[model samples]
Target: MKMAKIGLLLDEQTANKKWAERENVFAFYMKEVLDHFGIPYQVISENTDPMEEMDLLIAGLLNESDQAVQQLISYIKNGGAVLHLSDSPKLARWAGCQVDCGGPGYGYPAKELGYQKPVRFLKTNHWYRAAPADWNAKEGFLTDGSPEGPVIGELWMTIMAGSGKMVHCQADLPYSIVGLQQGLEPIHRDGVPAPDGTAGIDDGLLKADDSFTMDWSCDRETTDTGMNYFSEAYADRWREVFYHKLAEMALEKGLTVPFIGRWPAGIDQIATISHDSDFNLEESAEVTLSLLKECGIHSTWCMIEPGYESGMYKKIKQEGHELAYHYNALEVENGVWSEMEFKRQLQDLKTKTGLKHFCTNKNHYTLFKGWGELFEWCEKEGIQLDQSRGPSKKGNIGFLFGTCLPYFPIAWHTEKNRKYDVIELGFLTQDLNHHALADTTVIEPFLEEVQRIGGVAHFLFHQLHLLEQPKVGEAFRKVVREARARKFEFWTSEQISRWERARRRIKIDRLAPSGEPELSGEAPTASPVIWVPVPKHANVLGEEAEIRFGHLCIKKIPVFKQAQTS
Candidate 1:
């Protein structure tokens, strides 16, 4: 196997040290992309790369010195691949497109990555627009001996320097993406004021069924990854753009890779029928439980603060239904309760229900407010899973991370410094929408798309929706029957949370540089449904592994054997 060395070049002026030290979204998500593709990489700085031992070097908006620019150009011309994201004013002569510094330096609205975005070596003509078009560089400008003129098209140019290739891509990707992910106003993407404090819930808004909707938005260009949910949304095409580019770079260095899907098992889609226990579940528990029983579904029931052990406890314990906790956001927002109160709440629930610990969680208002602090509480309080990363502010309902599968969040933790895996199951397509806005029309297409892509199709329903809007009982029944008809995996929230932890622990290893690496851990037990993705082109060396789309599904083996060749 050939080893490929990829280096990330950094500029001092723009490389924020704090962001680098704390939660560096760029580095975190970039590594996620690389690891998914089985590509290994390292960070390279100006002072670093002395011997120039890299096959490819990636850099941000190049605002460095003239000497620094020439050094990279020389490397590329000498047979190295250079991916210069956004503009590089210093490399105007070689790149064939110069940054239009005379044009607006900033104040441009951000747009999603488009298919027509021009590229050089990439086989696909499309791209993921992580950042907005802040740089105004005209592509394919015919350069005279010195003077620049006759700029043609959106300035994305490519040049051949001896045996090497250089591409002046006209979009600022990682830089702007980081800002957007952190709920910041993407002024560079859209000329807007800085992010006004955290998004505020609407005062007098409620769904037709009287269920709460978390529809939020910012004036600036926003993404589901952030808070703004109600505003005009932009499609996050990161998967397509990043995957294509990574494959392109690897092929340049001689490597093949496959796209990673969300769901693990052969299950194309996942559906969770969750009932939020805002009202006293012990008294009214039979109502929701009977509904699930009628639908042939064992749903997840989450409680606000279980005060006493009642019929609900016996049902959850004996009936195979899952138990979870819910925090009331209105109590906190209205200053009626503090976070510390949850500690007592957990104890009260355990005492009443005789359940030692709780694992999964949702919120009263489906609020992600103070989630970081809430996660810390979850850790100290023994909560393992959180299903709160939804993208609704107060009226409209949608996806947050836009996936159905569960994942450990990287908001505060890094790879080396670890804590418990805060499994975030992205909640998409809630039940409130069907009655509130007749969004049943909007759901079928999404479910079909999820099936096509082999993703999850999770839906949340408040007990109030069932108790108050008795008219929409058929709508809920139809969704469950359809899911059963499709054979989608029906797991309780607790089951999903436990399964995700087990999934993460089973590390799938592959070869270095060529997209697959090594696994270093073990799962408590091999599950028939437990599946881990391996490289599509991986050589399993006669190992008993199920290969689908290059993913070697780790079968249930009592003894964990290292795949010597895979």
Candidate 2:
């Protein structure tokens, strides 16, 4: 197999300056990932003359620049495969291809906290249908003029046709460019370079075409990864069973699935504390953590602001519990605030309790307005992750929309600018949707999908809701135990965040300039030596010892028959 060379053409200046920076970073990182698979590539600035010998030509971060646009068309016409990222449909149409704009994109409202509508996949026969198969179509504004008619378009068009096969996307190029570079073929044909000083399509030769024809495409198979409930009574039970299966699958795949100790690895048990007056913080924290410890599990606690007793925040943290903000703006209904005010309140709360991450309550349904803006603010403030992009009532009910695991956020275009600061870590599943968990039988199938797609299984349970039902707790524990038996890893939100950070660092390192010194390594240390005091009456032959450490005390006895001892 001959090694292929790929070239990238990017506009260094434009409305996409930030995106350009990200693209550069990603290109470096991707080079490393591809190197692992034995692929070679290079990135060239837009100013360089077009090289006709490259296997693929990718255009990054382009806008409506007349000169740059003409160069791209010429590159494609000359038999060079092109991949376009973060551009408009007009570019695709100009290149002789079709583009679907999902529609007027909606932002979440702060009052809504997060989005809570189900996203459904509109059946399509596009080249990248595999994404929709693995992805759940949640609440989003589809581009206009599609068969679906104003639905949220999950796929963005970045590359369009000029003469050869071109791939386009609205998301960052680096994020989706790997697929194109690995697949498409460069086809050169004869054509006039649309006013650009570049080779026309008719002048170039085909250089091993096959950019989109690879057998290992990510979207090869399509299954319903949607979350829906069969019946109301079986919702909790279904969640338990689904979680158990998720752990089993993770173990099978050799991936650590982290969850509360009671559930399997990768299956998380989340308890929401909606009101401060409902439970005593100090007591509840101690009791909950103690119970979890007894069961060898750690759980996530969602806290509602202004609803808990004074000093409850400190108490919860002191107890070694996970804390997440639970927005209560929906409770007020008619309360409206500016984006600045909303961000100020969120920041103030973070300052008071030292809590940085949060998940909204039922208000996720209204995230398209205030909540979306807050997400942008979170990016500005350096918040690590957001878990608010779940399904609501307006979209498909009980569906998952993001990558099964954690991913960077797509850019959001405001009236003037675009922001891509925050990343989204999708919840595997939620209880309020009442879709997947409505029946116990659905557990096996639901979990199968989660494992197949490499997603986390999250179950949201309110303490009050479960207080009357101890069986629910037992069922949850059963799932956890099952997962542990399968060798899945349990994790807390903090742990997940840490892991994500580490992963990103690794990615960055791969993209860093070559010849950098290797990162440091650490060796395992010896286990602690335990000293036990012998009882005064104990003999050398056989003895018993009573040991004391801090508040713990234990008596040890030697069980031996009286042998021939001197």
Candidate 3:
């Protein structure tokens, strides 16, 4: 019935402590995750009573004193909930057992997290150094039976000791929250201006215009990961099951998971197809466009070549596809007047084609490199969308910003506060992820995964992929066909961008304890869509919630409450 009141407890003594340190990436991540899911939490002072003042005390307090650990033990024994990271033996002790801290400390999955292998729950393979808590796998015996470890790993375990629950996680939930400990660019010794971070708003040339700057590097994603040797952009990739449950464990009712997409009628996932052209002039440009045209779909093409005289480029524009500018990073790296060239090329394209607005772009090689200069130029040119922040890695489509959805990139500096008027559509997966990067032929598995997740699948297929091989085009056709079969509505880059623009306006004003859940917001589209969490707890049990766009009722679905943990 109420939100979880989370607390980041200080050590017993409050001297020389900074919980928001860069090294405390996990702490930052936990805060972001809590905010992302609308879970409210506060920082508790060490002098406060954990049993009284807090429903759950996040488990970093144990690092301070034996007395602190004893307090934690006492709190849990009396039914207090806590979630602690690291391979600390204190967790095993809380479970009335000892921890084995001598196991492998790399990324690995807790086999029991999901029903499928390669489940979205990716960890550093760190094992809790000991036998399975409360159970003997070798002897086939049980030590205790009341509160079993649902997420049982040799590295971590959750114990229902007394009335309290303790999740001893060794794989480091912080890393999961913020991929690759060093998410932010290097900050100065004084922690003022990060290396790639803007020196001042003026240096970034960020003006007081109608611009909304977004730091995709530090914002909420539906779910994101960019760890080496793994991917975090799978469908339904919200992998904080244990942490989420732990938060709910503190709540008497249950948890509330936000619905991600803005498709009409509560569609779970959105589908997109795009192409970024590099030097593949001879690439299968015609075949790809023809295929999309035949399938009755429009896409966005990031163009680099000057195709003023080319019929194919004209056909691309005439077919209702969007022409997004593509800037080459190699030219920038090679000092080839890259910025100037982009400006000149933009002018040339407009001059030749009489195109009014070049509203979208993707870096030829994702050379954004955390700079405001390029964005400054983009602002001057009136580009409304940037698709460069999609990948966490150069070649892979892992979770960089923890989401593949579109968001207004906000950039803030100490000297000046500014919002750049640009929507960043982070890339999800691309043709290269399989063919060019991994050299795989069949992308059925990848497409299947995208449909399974039911989020935006922004695929970047360089027409060049199908230059010599018709199979590439055919395979992409299969992607479209299969998506249609699954009820996925295809959209061009501009269409999706417009949808997001309208979606930002759709809002949930409040959820009442009775009556239809009150919603607030306007959609410019004729058949606009929205998803809102139902009236929670008992208010949701006897009835369903209705969602709408203007006078049109889009959905009247039952309120399916999240799994009640407590």
TM-score of each model, in listed order: 0.66, 0.49, 0.59
> What ranking emerges by lDDT with the best candidate at the front?
1, 3, 2
Report lDDT (CA) for all predictions.
0.49, 0.36, 0.49
Q: Write the per-residue lDDT of candidate 1 for residues 1-566, one digit (tens) a residue.
A: 34446766654444454345753334334444344333446666565554178776666434357777788878887888776664555576454443542220111111222322221111111122334433333222212111122222232335678788775444444432222222321111212212354332333322111222112222222333332232211213333344444445555556433332344545556778776776564545666777877877777777776432576578666877887777664644442234677676667777777789888777565544422556666878878887765634323344333334454444442332223356666565466444443344445544554554454566777666666676456667767767667767777877777655654444434344532334445533433232333444556665556643223443322234443444
Each candidate: RMSD: 9.4, 20.6, 11.5
* Per-residue C-alpha lDDT of model 3 across residues 1-566, encoded as one tens digit per residue: 23344676534342224332212323333544443333345755456554445667675434445665677777778877776655445545555565433221222233323324322222332334355434323211111111131433433456667876775555445444333312233212121221232122222211111021122222212222321212344212333344434433443324222322345554655667778765547336777767887888888888775543556668778888888787665543342334687687778767666677887888765544433556667888888787765442223334434445554433323212134567666565456433334222223444445455444666677777756555566666776776677777777778777776665544333344533233345534534332333232324444334421111122333232233344
- Candidate 1 lDDT trough over 10 residues, lowest sum: 117-126
**Most lDDT-accurate candidate:** 1
Model 2 poorest 10 in a row by lDDT: 522-531
Off by over 4 Å in 3: 1-26, 30-80, 84-113, 118-156, 159-164, 180-263, 279-289, 305-319, 332-359, 366-441, 464-469, 494-511, 514-566
Error of 1 at 88 (Å): 6.5
Clash count for each candidate, listed in order shown: 26, 81, 34
Score residue 329 of candidate 2 by CA lDDT. 41
Could you tell me the TM-score of candidate 1?
A: 0.66
Instruction: Kindly list the per-residue Cα lDDT of model 2 for residues 390-477, writing each as its tens digit.
Output: 4222112122232334444333223122324455543433333233233222344334444433344444444532343454445455
